[model samples]
Target chain A: MAHILVVDDDEIMRALLSGMLRHVGHTVVESDNGQGGLEQMNAYPAELVITDIFMPEMDGLEFLITLLEKHPDSKVIAISGGYKAVNACLSLQMAKALGATDIIAKPFHTAAVIRQVAYALQSKTIAYRRRAER
Target chain B: MNASQSEQIQNTEEGYPDFAKLTEMREELGDHFLLVMQHFQSGMLARPQKIRQAFQNNNPEQLALEGHSFKSLCRQLGLSQMETLSVTLESMGRSGQLDGAAPLIERLLAYGLQAHCELQKYCLACGKPSSVQ
Candidate 1:
């Protein structure tokens, strides 16, 4: 099982995601806001990071940028409810461009998310294998 | 599209029952029913006490904050009825209508009980005994 970090400003969202992740047999660490999320990532490395776009203190984009700077190999799954249309769209595009393995929209279907997470983990394994070969 | 056609189309898309989606999520989350239960329990236990305290102190701001938090949690848990009640409570708090909060609080409590029962049923079905918080 992979270690996963879930970050969202909404407490319920965090709880729901954490419950889902933990239920799937993955270890989950949660943070209520972007800044705290970033801190947790640095302190406790996770194989995957799932973050919400709009948040207090630091937004998801800023967190993503900082995270990549520190750990380019980290896999990220960005999620958003599209509450902020322009910003969310832009951030999603940026996340894809910055090498996030997947992006799931908010109110996501559970199976789709699970599939995407599995795909990302598999891809990460492949990348690590290639790196080892090099 | 004409108004009637547009309305029909909107309803068709929006009225798709969420049961299938919820079921898929439940399966994907595997045995993590316990975590969801814990979240529901925390919300169920904390919200009423916070609301009661706010009412006793006559603190509208605190009431509004608590209502907002409760509403957020309800929405997250897919507790639509409770979310609606919490929204009404939030509005009353915003308007400083403390007298209007009691009925809304009662409705919220009723919904909370319903949610608790639903969670319990889910646990029992999973062969896990309900653990009260």
Candidate 2:
């Protein structure tokens, strides 16, 4: 099980995602906003961060920028909803550019999320193993 | 335009050109989508002034909060169009480009309407009521 951080301004979405992650045997840390999420990342150091693109205090892109600056090895899963297609694509591209391992569109299924998270963790492990071998 | 031509136009413009995939995705996540849509519609109605005022005041914080909330709901519904627009608004809010956000906000509002209609069609097809109250 991976230690996951879920950051979103919406309490309901956070709760739902947390529940799903926990149900899949992953430990989840919740943050209501981007700043708090950043703080938690510094303090707790989760293996993965699933954050909504928009937020109060600090937006997801800002958080991502900071997260990458501080932790280059960080794995992020950027999520967006209620944005235009091109804009969402841009956000995803930005996240990928900044070091996010995967980007999932909003309104995603619990199964899909679980799969993505699992794949991310597995990929990280593979990369680590390869580096260690080198 | 004939029926097929109209369908093609609708598909191309909205970004989900594959009707079958869209329908399957909707069906696979119907309950979650409905819940998200309910919150989205209510949030829009409950905070129209707050949303508009945020844009007017160029308050990125307020816009970010509202956009984040809306974005979360959109994520749950898989409303790609709305989600993309929301991301732009979020970015604009982050950059303090309040003026630049208007067009994106308008696009988001339009996407919201389209999402509502699409949800209604899915609900009807699945014999579920469109009770997004």
Interface RMSD of each: 3.8, 5.9
A35-99: candidate 1 lDDT, tens digit per residue: 78778978988999998876657878888878877877888898864432243466677777766
Stretches of candidate 2 off by over 4 Å are A82-86, A125-134, B1-68, B71-133
Residue-level lDDT of model 1, residues B57-113, one tens digit each, is 898877776776676566545665565566566666777877756755665665566
Listed in order, the DockQ scores are 0.32, 0.18
Share of reference contacts found in each model:
0.55, 0.24
Candidate 1: residue A22 Cα off by (Å): 3.8
lDDT of 2: 0.67
**For model 2, what is the error of residue B58's alpha carbon versus the real structure, in angstroms, after optimal superposition?**
12
Stretch of 10 with least lDDT, candidate 1 chain B:
B9-18
Summarize candidate 2's per-residue lDDT along B17-128 as a digit string, tens digits.
1345445444444455445334544453443345567888878867865775665565565555555555556666766667646755665555566665665565566666
| Second chain alone, TM-score for each candidate | 0.72, 0.62
